[model samples]
Target: MSYTSFREPEASPPPSRPGLLRRLARDRRSMAASVAAVVIVVAAAVVYLADAATKPEVSNAANALVDTPPSAAQAEALGASPSASVSASVTPSAAATASAATAPKIPRTGWVPVDNTAWKAQVSAYNALKVDPVPAGVGNLPEFRADCQYSHSLPDDPIVAPGLPGASHMHSFVGNKAVDANTVAEDLTKFTATSCKPVQDHSAYWVPTLYDNATGKPVETTGFRVYYRSHMSNSTGQMPMPNGLRMITGDAKKKKPTPRGATGQFYCAFYGPGDLDGIARSTNGNWPICGGDATLHFMMQFPDCWDGKHLDSPNHKDHVAYGAGNTCPRSHPVKIPAITFDIRYGAKGTPAGYYLSSDKEGKSASSMHGDAFVMWDVDTMNKRTKNCVLQRRTCDNYGYQK
Candidate 1:
């Protein structure tokens, strides 16, 4: 009777399932948002600390990087992909590190020495081809006497000056030798200028157009550009010039004359290697001529070619001597033909002076001319140059006179 009146208990409503997005959104405040905020703050703090820690380290390490190029370890560390920690570590330093990595470095070539033997050979070859055979071992002559002076009139003057009284100012060194340029410069300071004193320091024997390994004939290097000025006496206090070097006027119209009144007057002197005889000893004294070390005095003057003497002399190789073909005290300015200084070392075509190349054109409108080795600055003839007869000793010194 009771069962008949009993009704089924109402079924519990099926549990409602929450959606994934809804569950995540509902959990965002408790688990995700708060955790994410804390995580962000901690990450920023780590980055700040890392930045602070690495700045001084990077600053100190930057100079070291310059001195010693990056090592494998440093490079690998830089290339590693960034994680949270890595990003914190590298972000502040990335710019500095990139700069350090890419900063310009002195090329290996800068520290390395160049072999000048090729140039030396070129000079020798040129001499061998000349009508007159250049003498052997030309630069081995003994030192000039302390007071010895070169003759300006005669073709050869024994212009040998002694090293300084206490210490030799002139150092006897050759190409790329182990001699301190500064010490040699100091010695040059003690050099007292006489009429015969050369205008250059630290002569390195050379001859133009020499062939390979031939050593055909050596020439006494007459001039060079030194790093410091050794002669304060010669300077007019107007402006400082290269050390142990003198500036002389080459071409007046093309170049300004020497401010200190120096002229293009230069004499030619020849020297040969010394033997056991006293003639060619290392002693500071004049070298005698006629087999006494083969010293000869010559001037840079140009004699008339038709005079039947010194007529065939050429300036360099295959080039007409300076002022050649130009008459003296003549009706008009003499036009001198220009030749290229070097086909291999210089630009194509005949140079500015004389016209004598396949690329030769008419003469330049200006009387002044230049070759690869010599340039005339037409600003004024009064301007001075490092040397009167340029040898183009340095890279900067190359090009027609200027």
Candidate 2:
């Protein structure tokens, strides 16, 4: 009875439980796997951040390549100078490309086709005309005059420093009243206001302003005479000057001493008997002192023959040449009217001397220069060339022979 009581219903053995050591081992393995997964996730995130940081650098390098200037070889292949810097990013429009392709190539020497179609047609018509025989015993001078008065002053030069206002030194302008740095060939025709006689002459003339060294004040011109003449003795076959012709005379960069006998030294001009080389010399020996009723005067002359191709050249002088004896050079076959500027100023010389606006050193007056931008009515130009220049007669402003 005691044994039976002790056995109290043997409960079924508790469901087979996993050993504690085995469970612990399994949990440790799971922990190790989770740790490895976290490490992998961190490594992936770091890689993503590093790759993102490098992408901008790569894009910047690509853009730099696109903006690089053309190489020397590439420029040569494109018919451009190696020194000419060009942007690779700028793509020319189709219309511009076509225009460039059709444009005439500038020649290294000799005549080339005129680039402007309208001008080319005019040239052809003029070349086809029959040249009338020059009258016997005609005077050697074949000239027409355009007497101009000073119009205004500005620090602009359309030929040398176009479109850049105040880039140049102060200049005294005559003839065309609306001339500025932004003026072009068409603008000369459009702005018809002029300070010259025969209002038809809408040309522009400019020279560096003369300044008094002692007062630092500008001495403007009182008389500006622009003469259009033939340089050749035989004026046959001379053509009318082309519209939009530009010319420059005297070297503005010349800084040499202009002593008493200098070739282009400023001189005295008066009606009565007075010394043309000034009454006294300046301290620097470059300026001349005028006597009573005398004034300062300068003369600038331009070439008379053109290349018949370019309206202008890189140097602004390569397109024209002075005739030798009675013949023009082969390269400049087209004879044109020569331009002469007689500029008179009201100031007399002082001991301090005078200086041109182009002269920065105030040492001498050797930097004197002049520029001419010629524009005229086509019919008027033609008539003057035929009646005065071609016929070897001196004509006044009204195109009438004097």
Candidate 3:
């Protein structure tokens, strides 16, 4: 399946031709150092990008596979990370040991691509743990839903589930539910031999809503922020992120405003359909809340697919690939980041200081956190009014229309 093109701001023209390195070197002290650093970084980036461009053949041939695990090298290319902990391989916890008693079952594939070298190793690790396969049975896990989390803001009002007009909606990016936080924590402790260190001040959250796709008019919404604390922290029991989870914001839909104006000015924000705008000025890399606020969520327990494709499951519209080339938000092209990981679960499994802040291994899988996943037809919580809305109407409907 394919996704619609996300409306993007007119990209500024490529940087003006810079003076040659030799010419720049002729300049005085600090400028020379900065230029040399920039050159080195740019060269490294080019090489990584070129290497990541080679798409692996996702296959079930089993025999023609390598034993390499996904690592930051590969993830950096894809613009995403694999899983936390690129070093420090930990032995399977009691949970994995108990579950491993059963034979590993290879997942069936076809719907999406699973060609990355790192992903294959991840699949192997998951199989070793005997985690349940993707339940939908169509293909590997939905690429968009498989990772730790893919952050983005909505461009239109979301559609709410039936019978829950005013119900709170939490994102299942990692498959943790409001009621499953405890279970998630238990499983984390049970899976790793490392002493379980509790993550602090974390909680689950869902700000569902439906507003005008064009006018930004709201139809319905839930208005409160749900905190999450069940996420796993490193063995030192220290929070990896000093500022917590950064606010992710990007308009993946890439929808053009009516009359053909640039909608790229929209920044990323935490709550409200119309909250926040633009990624650069408001993202973790910028001021006015540099790196912004840190928000955490429970990642799904089981491994899914890693092809980075859209999910076309029944009951769901398969928005990612549904309208390729269309103006719809989900039709945007799939941009897989370079994420890194390995089957080695011990202390030496991955690099230090890069993975999830919740784990001992610092190395994390980098995902396309630039865009926001849109949730429509749902009653989203509004902090300003401390109320909610549903389906183009106030969530408190009590009558039928003629």
For this target, which candidate reaches the highest lDDT against the unseen true structure?
2
What is the Cα-based lDDT of residue 242 in candidate 2? 77
For TM-score, candidate 1 versus 2, the one ahead is: 2
What clash count goes with each model?
50, 0, 111
**What is the model-wide C-alpha lDDT for candidate 2?**
0.71
Query: Candidate 3's residue-wise lDDT over 141-168, tens digit each?
Result: 1111111221222322112221122232
By TM-score rank, best first, the candidates go 2, 3, 1
TM-score of each: 0.16, 0.69, 0.20
Put down candidate 1 lDDT per residue, 109-178, tens digits, no spaces: 0011111343233223432331222233323211111111211111110011111122312222222121
Candidate number with the higher lDDT (2 or 3): 2
**Candidate 2 lDDT by residue in tens digits, 1-402:** 001111223333334655765766586677766654554444444332322211111112211221222233222222221121122343444433443454322112111123355565565666565544545554546888889999999999888776568999999999999998878778899999999987889999999998898888888998899989987677755777778777788888999888887888999998988898898999999999999989889998999876565566556676677877675555565678899998888888899988888885856878898999889887677777777888778777876543
Model 1 TM-score is 0.16
Q: What ranges in model 1 sit over 4 Å off?
A: 1-237, 242-292, 295-402
**If the candidates were sorted by their lDDT against the true structure, best first, what order would they fall in?**
2, 3, 1
Candidate 3's C-alpha runs over 4 A off are 1-38, 44-48, 51-402
lDDT of 1 at 230: 13
> Compared to the true structure, candidate 3 yields what TM-score?
0.20
Q: What stretches of model 2 exceed 4 Å from their correct place?
A: 1-116, 124-140
